[model samples]
Target: MAYTTLGDTGLDVSRLCLGCMNFGSERSWMMNDRDASVDLIHEALDLGINFLDTANVYSTGESEEIVGDAVASANRDELVLATKVFGEMRDGPNGSGLSRKHILDQVEASLDRLGTDYIDLYQIHRWDDDTPIEETLAALDHLVETGRVRYIGASTMTAYQFTKALYTSDIEDYSRFACMQPEYSAVARHEEANLLEVCEAEGVGVIPWSPLAGGFLTGKYERDGDPTDGTRGAASESVRGYFIEENWDVLDEIRALAEAKGATPAQVALAWLLHREVVDAPIIGPRSSEHLRENVGAVSVDLSDEEAARIEAPKTPRWPAAGKD
Candidate 1:
């Protein structure tokens, strides 16, 4: 696994990060494969995957506890641990947002659950429109100064919220978000509007989640109409099971390009994002060890100009909103 520096911060992270949303209780509805999750986490680290993305709300913090156990014995410096906050953990209003009380309270809670003293990259899981951006920044800055957090980032943010964050950081001398996480895939190209432009100019590492479009680009659904049937469709056991006719057309084009390159569609999809200048890394969420291997295999897949061009954005419903245009 090749490591890339996160923007200019000098924090080296693997180009592929393992998202741990399925680690704990969040695994309940999304992932009932705890044993598989644990094995995948260890194997990913063995494969030189140093970055592990988790969140407080994932499985209601059980995911953190699970991830905390996965790398308990590993050297801290050898890992690039990242997790998120700002999701509701309590019913009261104080339980959520980027407020100082919430931020400070959640940091320690995440630390305790993660079994670590400090977080490598602490991201606001989502933008808190209610709180002042400065208050959030000041609280985050305090975390850095006190050694509770090494760096800060944001996730699932709109262009407007992100712009304010940048200005607030500049004007207030608080720690700027070193990176931005958003859903970006061949199918979900919504972030192309202004987020990508700002991230490119500001040098914020763009870590794209769902590069596979929630398994849409895996090519597994190419045949048998959809992978939404039987075992694979358990997650999305709807009428279409997360696969539809239009998505099939888009997936077909990508598959043809992959076949031409002797690669899988999933690999080709990730390579497209990896080649983009704005992207620093693409978060790969897999359910099994086999999927982990397949996802990592994408690192070696290369796409030519023509092949890359063949995999353009289609007129489909975008889920991630990070790979717009």
Candidate 2:
């Protein structure tokens, strides 16, 4: 497992972060079995993957508990454990968002669930329009200062909002967001238009979620065929949005490139993101041990500039790519 620093920081993380969203029973497609989820996480650790990304909203914190159980015996000092805030964790007023009350409350809950005293990276799951960015940044800054969280991050927001947050952090002496978690993939290139440039200029690390376009670039779903039952495309309208002429075209090139390179389409797609200079890691959510091992293989599948361009040639870069807020 190749490792890289979480941009602008000396912190080392695996090239592929293990996303823990699937470790709970919130959805039918999730790995509902606790033992199985723990086993998959252990498999990832065995494969040298040290970065784990989870969120308090995922299965209402069940995922974090499972991650804690799985990593109980591992060397804690070598791992980079990350989880998110700004999601509805309970009912009523203070249940969610990045308000100081919510941020402070959630961090304790997350630490308890993960069975860890300090989180390596704590991220806001989404932009909170209702709360002032100042309050949110200040709360996060408190976390960093108090040693509850080592670094802070943001996910899936407009470029302007991100810039403002960074600027605010600079002026307020708050803990700036050190990384970004965007929904980037071979097919979803919206971040390229604006958000990515901001991250590049600001030296913020990017760890993109859905690097496979929700399995679209895996070559599992076809334009003329119905989505297979139990697949994300079959259930998620957002995932189904990838079933377009352009993304299909991108998948075709990806499939061809994978065959030529003797690699799986998933590996090729992830490798495409890995090729980008601004991307520090692409979070991989694997349901099985087999899937975990296959995704880790992307670190070895080197892609030349031309090969990477072919994957991008089919899709034009656009702002606020489909389903992204």
Candidate 3:
């Protein structure tokens, strides 16, 4: 429930953001029940978790709708709602991308679906290779002017793409992304390439997704144990791929660290991201309320410097991208 500044936008956001990717059924593997969804949203709100992340492409916009309706009854001023466009909305040549037409149209659609007059944060879900960056930036700027979007951000963008967008925004005087959402975790540190440095230099807030590396840091899937259980850890090809032989030693080291801290591996993992200077919010997506509680407890569970240095991850500087505050 702790709040921090969201990058350069100056909006105070919760340290733990509720990722509503599973709010709608079609686009999510875990989130399906509308009642549970509402309950979970309320739970997040009760915990002072004011930040919620959704996308227009999630479940073809079902996620946004659910979040919009779920938070509608809550204190409007107490929440910060975020959604993204730039993906195909439906089957069509122009159903997706960041063209002016698509961005403008999707903004309205997202606003209407969420039942909110304005969005706290609007983002491009991914880079639109086909659309010109200027077109997208201008359209986003228009949204800002009209009060439909308070701030804009970009997600899943590479170092070059993010930098290009930043440069374009500076020169063109258009709406630019204030935040960057990328994958980061103990097991995955790929973003450590120049992206983190660029974010730091550009003053873009870092909202990391999958801070647990898709349940890999939960410390459940051991190499010596049964491998298949239909768990998020077992079902993910990336998790399987990330689960290499050397990681066993790495995980053992982490297990020792977790034991010393008197916390679960997931708790220690999320705490690492929370304290990381570059991270503004570490997105936490739990399947159930219990999981959510366990993850939330990480915010208060402090890790010592020695315990933190014991985690097995890529060599420093190879990927400084994983940990988000």
Candidate 4:
């Protein structure tokens, strides 16, 4: 596994973060086996993956528990453990959002579940329009000051919201977000419009989620046929959004390039993210050992500038290319 610092921070993390969302039984497509999840995490750790990203809401903290169990025998100091807040972890009052009360309450719960006192990186799962950004940032700053969280980050949100949070942190002396977790892949280039440019300008590290476009770029789903049974695309309506003709064209390009390089389409797709200068790591959530190994293999698959461009040409970029009106 390749290692790099998280954004501009000195905290070293694997180029591919092990996403723990699939470890729980919350969804039909999830692994749903605690032992199996633990084993998968162990396999990833053995393969040199030091970064693990999970959230309190994933299977109601079951994923974190599984991660905690898997990392128990490993060297703790070498791992970069991350988790998220701003998700509904319970019912009724104080159940979610980035409010100070929820954040304070959730951090302890996350630490207890993860069996760790300090989170290497704690992120807000989404923008909390309900709570003031100042309140949220102050709470996260408290986490950093108290040593409960080493660094703070944000997930999918508008460029304006992210910029506001960053600016608020600068003025308030709060813990600034060190990185961002955006939905970015060869098939999903929407962030390139403004969010990515802001991240680039602000020197924030980007660890993109769903780097394979929910398995669309892997060519697992047939263009003319429905998703195979038991697949995430089969179970998730959001995944079905990638079935349009345009994404199929993107997959065609990826498939051709993969054949030429003697690599799986998934590897070629992930390698495209690895090739981006803004991407510090692309979080890979593999349910099985085979999938984990295949995704990890992407680290070694090099792509030339022309090949990368070919993979991108099928989809029109949300942001206009430089020198183009």
Give the top-scoring candidate (TM-score). 2
Candidate 4 error regions (>4 Å): 319-325
Please list all clashing residue pairs in model 4, or write none if there are none.
Answer: none
Which has the greatest lDDT?
2
Estimate, for each residue in 1-325, the C-alpha lDDT of model 4 and write its tens digit: 8899988899999999999999999988899899999999999999999999999999999998999999989898999999999899889999999999999999999999999889999999999989999999999999999999999999998888999999999999888999999989888888889689999899899999999878877788898898889887988887888777777888899899899989999999999999999999999989889999999999999999999998888777564322110
lDDT of 1 by residue, 191-220 (tens): 876577788888889999878876768876
lDDT of 2 by residue, 1-325 (tens): 8999999999999999999999999998899999999989988999999999999999999999999999999999999999999988888999999999999999999999999999999999999999999999999999999999999999999999999999999999999999999989988888899799999999999999999878887789988999999999898888888878888888899999999999999999999999999999999999988888889999999999999989889788887555432
Q: Which stretches of candidate 3 lie over 4 Å from their true place?
A: 312-325
* Candidate 3 per-residue C-alpha lDDT over 1-325 given as tens digits, one digit per residue, 9 for 90 to 100: 6789988767999999999887878733567898899888888889889999989988888888889878889988878899988877889777999999998889999999999999999988888889889888999999999999999988887798898899999999988788999887666666767577788888898899888877777888888775557676666676666576555655677677788878888988888887677889888888789988988988898866766666644334454343321
**Clashing pairs for predicted structure model 1, backbone only:** 24-63, 25-59, 26-59, 189-323, 189-324, 191-321
The lDDT per prediction is 0.82, 0.93, 0.82, 0.91
TM-score of each: 0.91, 0.98, 0.93, 0.97
RMSD of each: 2.9, 1.2, 2.7, 2.9
Using TM-score as the yardstick, the better of models 2 and 3 is: 2
Ranking by TM-score: 2, 4, 3, 1
Error of 4 at 119 (Å): 0.4
